[model samples]
Target chain A: MIPIKKQYRRLRSLLFALSSVIMFFIFWELIALYSPSPYVPDPYSVLKAFITMLTVGDIDGYTLTWHALVSLERVLLGFIVGAATGVPIGMLLGIKPTLKGAVTPIIEPLRFIPPIAWIPLSIVLLIGLWRYIFLIWIGVFFPVLLDTIAGVKRTSITLIQMAKTFGADNKKIIARVIFPSSLPEIMNGLRVGLGVGWMCIVAAEMIGGEPVGLGRLILKYANLLQIDVVIVGMITIGLIGLTLNYFILLLEKRLFKWRVEIRA
Target chain B: MKKAILLESVSKKYEVGSSSLEVIKSLTFDVNENEFVCIVGPSGCGKTTLLRLVSGLEPPTSGRILIFGDPPDPRKQRFGVIFQEDSLLPWRTVIGNVKFGLELQGYKESEHEKIARTYIELVGLQGFENYYPHQISGGMKKRVAIARALAINPDLILMDEPFADLDAQTRSLMQRELLNIWSKLNKTVLFITHNVEEAVFLAQRVFVLTKRPSRVKQIINIDLPYPRARLSPPFISYRERILTAFHEELEGI
Candidate 1:
């Protein structure tokens, strides 16, 4: 059980967060009232637009949930594809020092080019779904690869030697020792990769001007001066990103029960 | 008295960047079946390197090593190794870590579980079989490593300073428990340590090694009986002898 003092501290922190959010909304409302421009819609107007978009649908006859689903599909598809390719290649390179060394020079330059920078090339060369996937792939691939390599390299020499003394061959050693031990790091890589993929979603949808995505809806509404709807789109993206990261954290907790709990 | 391990002029040289560093030079010894031998030396005297060579984890630069009659081939001749550091897989439960060797040997889950449980019980960790390495104390972790090594039913067991990290009280308790287990199992053990008292307490014969480019300086037979009293005059003399050898090596350095 948590001590009373610690619990009280936690409660105090929660209250502080709630008060800060209230303060932000109040400040925004004051700004909207004084501003001459129509672009800065207050928090209440954004909330009102959000409910209407969810229930009554937007002007294009599609609901906010539909836009969210489209964005989610792109993110999930691209994330899965990127992980499938990245993990195996990462494991191969991680196990073979010579292969990693040879590949490093070529990959080092490419890794520096972020997902957004690939936009111009993707828009020109890729067609339809591939363009979105390509952009998100570029975002997700490197972190997962690098983390997996680090995890494998960080495998304890003591454990490997112990395994060898038990008469374990290379394949058995890798399967029984290397893979399971490296999982915590791999999960961490996946979480970071998913975050990058979600960040790239806005630019990815912007590439082809996709008709149904949150990114597209935000831009489309902004063009018509519907600042309230644009704010709703932005809020949805933030909430979804938070939800995705929370989901990964929960999964990590369940899978790695042996890991020391780091409750910061 | 069958020879379980034989080392003939065993030497290990590690090439560091440009220059070659010799860690072990001409270590010749034989460990008989069911005998417990300890290699005690000053720190960085290549006690670990010698163990690595005997376990076939590394090849000797110019000497021959044999397990039983054949060359030290880890894949062909099974050996149990316990490292100085905690090598227990944090992700595995006590039983799972013990079952690791059986799993690699292609034993079915059902069969391996029974074998693993026996060793876990042998190490007095039966009730804590489900506990992870992190959940246990340091002493328990060492026991789990022991159970893991012994579960494989290896011909020889090589331990490198297995209790070096334990508290003094726990270390003494563990030593007694280890002796109990060793007598019961009748397994050959080649243990290494830097502590003179630990060598005197555990080993039937203590092989002292000199400083860098280490070689056997003296092999002292512990003629003392089991449950050997640390405060006993014989035990004190044994400790003094090894300590004096260590001091001589330091002085030479």
Candidate 2:
């Protein structure tokens, strides 16, 4: 049970956040009223559009929910593949300096190129979903890879020494000590990678000739001067990104409870 | 009595920049089976280095270190080492940390919890078995380290000022607890500490060392029985002797 003082503090913070959001919508409504621009839809119009997109089918041959689901699927698949491959490669490079030296020169250059920048080449190389996946994978890969490597490198020497003195072989040491020790950093990597992947998926969908994705819907509606639908798409993307980040944070809290308690 | 460890002319030198610094200079000592021995020296006297060399964590520049009539190899003969640092795995609970050595040894999964719990209880941490290292006090964390070490059931234990981080009262309490456990287990122990009183209180024999490039200065035997009184005449006299030997080295420097 929370104390009254703590409960009051939490309630105050919540009210503060809610008021700021309400003020933002009011400011946006006032701008819409004064400007009378078709491009800048009012908050109420966007909300109505959001509900219409939710209930009605055939916005762009599919409902808004379908478009959001398709985008989420692509991002999820791309992020999973990126993490699965990147973590192992990163662990290998972290443990084996010679291999890192050999591969770093190749990867270092590729890391600088933004994922959205790869859309043209990805389209030429692949078709439809694969192109979007490729772009999303590129977006997710580098952060996870670099962070995993850094985490592995930062494992405490004392922990490693302790493992070794207990007669642990190289494999056991990595599995038991280094991997668990590097988890917080790896989780950070995944969080950052997922955020990048979300953005890349939206950008990729806008140009990848995809018919049913939130990004494609926004692009289509904007071309037709349906500003409310476009705003709905934009808001959906933000909400989904926020939800994904919250899920990752929840996982981190569960897994690294010891770490959290230590900081507290 | 059987000899548990024998170090002959062990020397360790570290190469800093271009010049090499000798840390342990031709140090020679032997610890018997089931004996509790402490090495007391001034702070930063290469005492930890000596333990590291003995444990084969680091190699000596020159000398022979034998454990039970063989060269010291962690794989060949297990030696539980408790470092000055808590060294508890933050992610693991008390029982989990205690079971770590057993897991590395590839013991049966079924046996781990039981064995770990036994040691945890032995270290007076029965109720805190599921508590993570971060959740425990410094003294409790040290107890976890001890439990982890003892759970391995190693041939010998090498401790490097394991209680040095605790407060004076907690340090004395832990020393007593350690003595209780050691007597019951009859484990061979080589403890390193800068505290002269701690050395005399816990050890059957105390080896005093010089300040830097440390060599064995003297070995004093504490003839007092177990459950030694802190204020007793013999205990005080032994403590004084070790203190004087330690101060002489400091003064010479």
DockQ of predicted model 2: 0.69
TM-score of each: 0.95, 0.94
lDDT by residue (B1-253, candidate 1, tens digit) is 4489888898889999999999998888888899999998889899888888888888899988888888887878778888889898889988888888877756687889889999989999879989988889999999998888888788888999999999999999999999998999999999999988999999999999989899889999999999999999999999999899878998887
Candidate 2: TM-score?
Answer: 0.94
DockQ category of candidate 1: medium
DockQ of each: 0.80, 0.69
User: How would you encode candidate 1's per-residue C-alpha lDDT over A49-72 as one tens digit per residue?
Assistant: 999999988888889999999999
lDDT of 2 by residue, B52-115 (tens): 7878788889999889988877777787999888698999988989999999887899999999
- Stretches of candidate 1 off by over 4 Å are A1-11
DockQ category of candidate 2? medium
Kindly list the per-residue Cα lDDT of model 2 for residues A1-264, writing each as its tens digit: 999999999999999999999999999999998885657889998889888888894455588889899999999989999899889888999999899999989999999998778878887899867887788899899999999999999998888888888888899989999999988889999999999999886678866465788888888888889999888988999999999999999899888988955255
The lDDT, on a scale of 0 to 1, for candidate 1 is 0.89
